[model samples]
Target: MSLKPGNIVEGKVVNITKFGAFVEVEGKIGLLHISEISNSYVKDVSEYLKENDIVKVKIVSIGEDGKISLSIKQANLEEQKKSCKPEEVDWNSKKRKTNSIDFEDTLSKFLKESEEKFKDLKNYKNLKNGTYAKKKNR
Candidate 1:
């Protein structure tokens, strides 16, 4: 079977390295990079895959020199979609929750805190320039 970009196919892990694993798909070898092994961080490629292990992979790219790049994570699109559930909020509830502060209030609070910090900085600068007096030690 001909393999192209976005093609999902079954492959065997022929060889593994620190960087990635080589997969044999339909008599053709493809490189499954460590990053493409999973959506999460992969500290060890061997931990997730091993030699001769069968896995489904997606063809991410094909170089002119016949270097095929594959992705195990990208092949499982259904699994990724199933795991991600949209958060639903009840907008019609009569008892409106006021506990969560709105954006405008948060912005105003941040600006007030920023102004206080600027004032403190200005005072410190004045003290450093000898324009502001330091209290004498009794």
Candidate 2:
């Protein structure tokens, strides 16, 4: 089959290098770069793909000489669709249980605690400066 730029195909890894893997697709070779392997950061290419491993890859680029570049990330996304079933939800199926305090109440408590701390600090500063005095009732 003729490989196109948008086609996703299965290929056997023929060789692996620090930069990428050379995969053979229908007797034609393609470069599966390390960056194209996954969405996550890959510290080492051998950890995921190895020589002689068959993997599904998406055609990324086609050069003037027909050298193909492929991506494993695209292939995995396609495979995940096939193995997983669609989830359907009924509005009354189950009620979601909430396990948290009221947001406004939490904020008010935090503010009160902060004001007390600030007043304590101000009192300490005034006492250190010899200006602290007790207020008397008239």
Q: Each model's TM-score? A: 0.58, 0.73
lDDT of 2 at 110: 100
Least lDDT summed over 10 consecutive residues: which range in candidate 2? 129-138
Clashes of 2: 0
lDDT of 2 by residue, 65-99 (tens): 88898999988887787799978878787665587
Runs in model 2 lying further than 4 Å from the true structure:
78-99, 131-138
Candidate whose TM-score is highest: 2
* True-vs-predicted CA distance for residue 137, candidate 2, Å: 30
For candidate 1, write residues 1-138 as lDDT tens digits: 689998889999999999999999999999999999988999999999989999999999999999999999999984567689999988897785679888899999999999999999999998876743444432
Residue 86 in model 1: lDDT: 92
Candidate 1 residue pairs in clash (backbone atoms < 3 Å): none
Among residues 3 or more apart in sequence or in different chains, the pairs in candidate 2 whose N, CA or C atoms overlap within 3 Å are none
> What lDDT score goes with residue 130 in model 1?
71
